[model samples]
Target: MFIDEAEIEVFAGRGGSGCLSFHREKFVPKGGPDGGDGGKGGDVVFVGDENLHTLMDSKYKKHYRAKNGSPGEGSNKTGKNGENAEIAVPLGTIFREDGKVIGEILSHGERFAAAAGGKGGRGNARFKSPTNRAPREFETGREGEKKLLKLELKLLADVGLVGFPNAGKSTLISVLSSAKPKIADYPFTTLIPNLGIVDCFNYRSFVIADIPGLIEGAHTGKGLGIQFIKHIERTSMLLFLIDMTEQNPKKAFDVLKGELKKFNPEILEKPMLIVLTKTDIDPDAKFPKRIGGIPVYPISSISRTGLEELKHYCCETVLRNN
Candidate 1:
């Protein structure tokens, strides 16, 4: 039920019409115009809620409309305004119209107006003139705005884990944080992205995201990688996880980098670290101390070897960058 994208239509309320009435009294022979003005319409607004993590609610509901204003009454009394329509959405939700970016919600309780209500019409009393005592002119109300919007949700995390299938990304994240992702020996085990909050010294914490594995040609929709790759765009740092038992760790690192660069070249500019996982499985295996000028950290999720050092480094690096 983790929906990331949805399409919906929004409609604003319409204004009420003006009332035309003539004042009449038992004693007076002729009374002037005593019309009342109409009330304004309501707007369609979207609110951000941090408790929500997906766009599932928007997926089922397609259309939203606000309440219409009431008509004006006699005796120069104005009508009541319509009620607003508010829709709750998750943080990091982006709204688009006709493939163009309109706005985004990144904080809790943030509101964005998708459509505006129409203006109210003028009453006949506003058209009273000294020369024409019995003028009966009245104005009509205007229509509200309507639009079809697209919603896209992107995860917000401090660090992103990048690696091939079965490269111990899930295992590493589980050990580093409290996230429990489905792990198996086969490829494409993780179909969705998982987020975890890693606590550091002094109650400081940072969020980490573990997305689906990436393979060669992932940018071309080769596997599940293309669908989940965009989830890493918000991360401040990246961790390149590689299997220490691989025949050539350097080639693996190169493929991962190539896929990421192909999807978004800007991702390469972010600060990154190379991590060799499952070190306990191959204690004697040899890996380069550094890959492509980036330092390496070898750790075993099962035995918890080199985990404290890695955690300390990640905490300090993320804090320093922030």
Candidate 2:
């Protein structure tokens, strides 16, 4: 039910037309022209709601429209303005126009105007002058602008856990944070992204996102990895977890790195922490450390081993980057 992308159409309300009428008085025989200007239309807006984590609501409903303004009255009264339409979406959502990012919503209550209302028409009352006693012409209202917008949700997390299936990435996230994701020994257990808030001392907090696992050709859509790879774009940091108990940890790490690189070169530039998961299988194997100069932390999420070190490391990295 966690939808990340959606396409929607938004239409602004049209302005009301002007009204022209002759003023009649009880005492006077004749009266000047009494015309009223039309009211302006309403706008279509989008607001970011932090309480929402998915774009599922927008999936079924793709079209949004505002109400039109009322026409002018005969008593020189202007019409009522149109009602505005507001659509709520998850935070960290980005609006695109023709595949290009036009706006981004990162905080709650943040709003963006998707379409502008049309302008109201002018009345004919101003035409009265010395040379021209009365003018019967009136202008019509202009139409509102319509737009097709594409919205994409990129989860905002302080830490993004990335690895292959059964790599204990989910276990690490669940143990480190308050998230309780479905855990199994089989591959591709996590099909969607799981978010959890990690609380530290002094009320410090951060969001961790655990997405589906990656495969060798993940970048080529061989698995669900490519589809969710964009979720890592907005993460402040990455936790690359590898199952060191496997025969070759280096090869696994390389495949994960290669997939990231293939999907987006910028992913390689992100701050990463290599974590060797399930160290309970082989306590003394520093298999992850042999990868290179990258920071490596060997920990067993199930046994609660080296958890403090990993937490401290993640927190320190986040703070340093901030």
Candidate 3:
């Protein structure tokens, strides 16, 4: 399952209490306080794992907690600290608390401390003084931190495919890379984002992301909505794919651009290319030389027409931008 979002509660371990014992020996004349300090609690941490692609584990397990520290023992012996609880999540996962961004893990083996452990308490021996040698005062351990956090995962890719339903996005990616995404003639065949690593000449390659199709009201929760749109926010470039079979290609391009602009205007600032797909279906069909000042490339994934040129161009553009 491709679960991108999840909510979880984290609880840090509590510290142990201090011991209030007094020294008792057979030969010692004056036995002073011999209490030991408590051990510190454990923290809750989140680790980034590149191998993980979904937040399914976090979704199923909504709560997490660290081990608590042991209490202090007699004979000036301190308690053992609790073990930390580490939760592994996919890279590019963002943590939020109360609608505010807290932290994010973007690299493999990276860790983020979600909740902090409590401090240990002071032992009775620490209160010993000249006037009060037999001090009995001891401190209690502090409580650990608790948090309700939200996790959001965004796919990391070099290029993002932006298009409406049945625009041949999946078909292009399948031919360019080893990624095999479910493709059908119907709309909304791709319910989740698919990634493919397109290899260019000289062993150079770039990752491409194909998200769910967008519609005119995609920014307003229509069709697949903005759920999959955010996955492309981190992309270095955008590829606008249009179906040549559409009656009004210009209107389709405008609508796709408008939806992206409404969701996030910065997306328009990225390097982009306009691709008209299904050229083999209508070889004699005419298209604009340029759309919104961007060059257009018409290709047919079925017949592999113009695939090499498109692949080379995409690779060079992505490599240069990087």
Candidate 4:
């Protein structure tokens, strides 16, 4: 189950109460007051881990609470502090509180404090005065912080691959990376987006996301892109794949572009590449050199022709963009 969004509640531990006691000895009739201070409360923290790709764990567990602090003991013995609650999430996770984004974790081992613990109270010994020999007052512990959070995951990748269904997207990604996605001849074969790490020359590589296919009504939530388009918004570059054998390739490109524009015009502003797939079908066929102002490249994944050049170009383009 690939879950990208979740809601959870986090609470920090409460501080311990102060201790009050009077010193007593057999030899001395009246001994000064001897009391211990309370221990601190536990905090709730969130950490980013590269190993986690989905927010499925957060979806299953909706609430989290930290351990409470221990109370103080007599004879100036402080109580033990409570342990902290650590929550691990994937990179590119955004934390939102009350419909507004508070912070985001983008790197591995990144730590963010979701809620802070309460401070411990003071002991009666701290209240002792020179004028008053016996002062019987002590401070109380503070309450922990509590918050309701919304977690949203935007997949991190260097390049985003977008195309209509049956445009050879899965086949192309299979050749570019080790990811083995289910491929079919029909439309909408891929129900979920797949991330593949494309290895280029000299073992240099970058990440690519194969977003689900889009259709004419995709922008209106008629197809898969409505749910997967958010993934492409985070990418630095985009690859628009079109079928060369289609009756009119330019018209097909226009439809795809229109859908993307409707969703978010900013997406079209990114660095984009126009790719015509299935070039192996007609080696002698001629197509337009460019789509609008963007350069168009012809390639066939099965024949492996033009693939090497494409890989090197992708590597260079990503490096330049980075």
Higher-lDDT candidate of 1 and 3: 3
- Number of the top-ranking candidate, with TM-score as the measure: 3
- State the lDDT of candidate 3 residue by residue for 1-322, as single tens digits: 1238999999999988888989889999778898888888899999989789899999899999998877776788888888899999998898999999899886689899999888778789888999999898988888999999999986578899999999999999999999999999999999988998899888888889999999989888999897667668767789999998888877888999999999889989988889999999989978788987888999999989988988888888888976
Model 3 vs. true fold: TM: 0.61
Candidate 2 has what TM-score? 0.59
For candidate 4, lDDT tens digit of each residue in 165-266?
999888888999998988999999988888888987676788888888999999778776476776677577888899889888778888888988997889
TM-score of each model, paired residue for residue = 0.60, 0.59, 0.61, 0.59
Residues 56-120, model 2: lDDT tens digits: 88889988999887777666778788888999989888888888878878668889988888877
Better of 3 and 4 by TM-score: 3
lDDT, candidate 1, residue 310? 84
Q: Write the per-residue lDDT of candidate 1 for residues 1-322, one digit (tens) a residue.
A: 1239999999998887777877888999888888887778889999989789899999999999988776676778777787889999998898999999898786688899999988777778878898878768876767878999999986577798999999998998899988889989998888888888899999998888898999998888887757566677657789999988888888998999999998788988988889999999978877777998988999999889988998888898888876
Once model 3 is optimally superposed onto the true structure by TM-score, how far is the C-alpha of residue 114 displaced, in angstroms? 4.6
Model 4: per-residue Cα lDDT at residue 19: 78
Model 1 misplaced stretches (Cα beyond 4 Å): 1-91, 94-155
Q: Which stretches of candidate 2 lie over 4 Å from their true place?
A: 1-10, 13-91, 94-155, 288-290
* Best lDDT among the predictions, by candidate number: 3
Ranking by lDDT: 3, 1, 4, 2
State candidate 4's TM-score. 0.59
